[model samples]
Target: MATKGRRALRLLGAPHITVACLLWFGVLTVWGTLYQADPLHGLHGAVQRFFHSWFFLAGGVVPLPGVQGTSALFLANLFASMLTRFERPSRAIGLWIVHVGLVVLFLGGLLSRQYGRETTLVLADGEKASMSVSETGWEIAVLTPGAEGRREVRAYDVRNLRAGGSLAVPGVPGSVGVVRVIYAAVVSPAAGLTPSPEQVTDAPAASDPRMDRPAVVLRAGDERLVLLGEGPAAVLHLEGGGEAHLLLRRARLPLPVSVKLIDFEKKFHPNSGIARSFSSRVEVDSGGRAREVTISMNRPYRHGAFTFFQSSYMDNPRGPEVSIFAVSENHARLLPYAATLIMFAGMAVHYLPRRRRT
Candidate 1:
């Protein structure tokens, strides 16, 4: 290697650089915890500022390195150390394996952050579905009823739309535009106004974003329709004697496999209204085959890259029970475990001796 190149590698592998990165990492952890304690900046804000970004504007002005940059620097240090310091072969085999394991852990975390997804799968007894819903994103769907009661759905993402912004929905005549969006509101019938009256007024937005009930006003053809996130579908009669149902709802994600709620059971406390435990018997159908599995409080079911846990349950006074599963997809699910095992083996090789020194 060139003289400059060798010097740069030595600098990268310096112990002081490693120490500084570790100290910065600990500072970030402490600061993130303290920042989340404030009501204005919750856990999401802290994560976005500290973990997601490479650098953040400290106090909305000065730039400061975050966990992302720190991790990158730490990784560079490890690589440089392997290339510059651990150049021998006879007695450094275990050290090489240990370094490789540490590298895997850092790279695995990066891959997981880029590809991991978290969503909810909701199913009622005897109902099977292959789609999960996003927790915070909202969409507008237009459903046209077809033969055999099946509806053709055309959904548009409206989470980024501002007040009075428009959406050009396919197969719908004229313009479809949004007038207003309320994050949380009280919706009611507007009484004697025009042909019908759909009234809505604003309310306080919930701190937990999932609890927010959003409403959107859309101009479909010539009629103005009010659609609520968790409300009933509004119908718009088309010019050709057909009708389209308008709905504002959480965004749905298509899944690789279908899951059905075979049975849902929950046990209450000994004598109180609080629930003690719940479980779901689900049938996962994939690749033309089906199998049954139980997902309970601590036991989660894994299929392919997705894992499902019994997150919550709901009991209707007049209807059936609903089972909600928290599903997460992590492509690097086993990387951490593999890295840990490799590290342990390397440590044993480096330290353990069968017949010598205590």
Candidate 2:
């Protein structure tokens, strides 16, 4: 048993694993870059398949491990090396800190990938919002119409579900069983001579997920309903008189504070239509204490654990000026900076003494 444990530790801390991971990183870099040049699969698609996913099919046939898988392997290697190789010797002290720093950085990346969220909040001039929504995720919102044109909207989570999974919609009788899903669907009116349901065919996924219109067939209370995400909500007549409206829309997260866009300003270059700089002054209201802050290209505003950066500006031809803010909630973002400093100190300890002696 001791011999087997030693062998396993040796394998985990082997230099070949490091070399293979580094080489795979290079390969993925080149492959993702080449793939990004394709119009259909842009940077987002490339990153999703190569960097974000645990596995991706190469050339649509060969299954290969992605960056997430390689990162996990490298993390294991670092931990094993720290346990089995690095010791309390004075000369090894710097190596110990370096390995520990690397582990911290890697774990931070993993935590950010697994638990962190990236959401977007769009505000037109003079508009305020307390909700930031997911860019590529969708959820089902069930609406009930009330008296005097008032309606109650309640959203349910569908992001964790697959085609075979079920979604528990509140206020509804039965759980919605997902029968089929088309991520990028082309919805067309029924074209047959006889009466039939609409035709939904899968199309190539849009580079921006917001542009993709999904179609889903759901089994809800013995009624099989086909709903398209782009159009009007599918209605389910209630036994108690009124109807329940169901629509799949972008998932949203309510913020603790409300943000209102005061004004958006843009500066253009001399004699050119190109934009030189742009910024948005926004009011953040928390507990009725409102404060105005500027968010620009280089500067991000932080409130509590949330950080908002000015991500996009749209000068809508038909309406008001729109400013989009990228909101990130990653508590582990500071770990990488701390790990970098630790690594720097380790490198100084490892090299400075040798330099002085020489």
Top TM-score hit: 2
Model 2 lDDT tens row, 1-358: 9989977987898889988988998999999999889988888888888989899997799999898999999999988777777756476878888888998998999888988889999999999999999977777787887679888787756555578777655456767788877777775555331211346678988875667877777888667777666456777776567888888787888888999999998899999989998899999999899999999999999986689998989978899999999999888889999999999998888888889999
Q: Write the per-residue lDDT of candidate 1 for residues 134-209, one digit (tens) a residue.
A: 8877888878867798888878776687777887654567668888877786655553222222477787765456
Model 2 compared with the native: what TM-score?
0.87
Which regions in candidate 1 have their CA more than 4 angstroms from the true location? Answer: 138-248, 352-358
Alpha-carbon shift of residue 10 in model 2 (angstroms):
1.5
TM-score of each: 0.73, 0.87
Least accurate 10 contiguous residues by lDDT in model 1: 189-198
Compared with the true structure, the alpha-carbon lDDT of candidate 1 equals: 0.82
lDDT agreement with native, every candidate: 0.82, 0.83
Per-residue error (Å), model 1, residue 28: 2.7
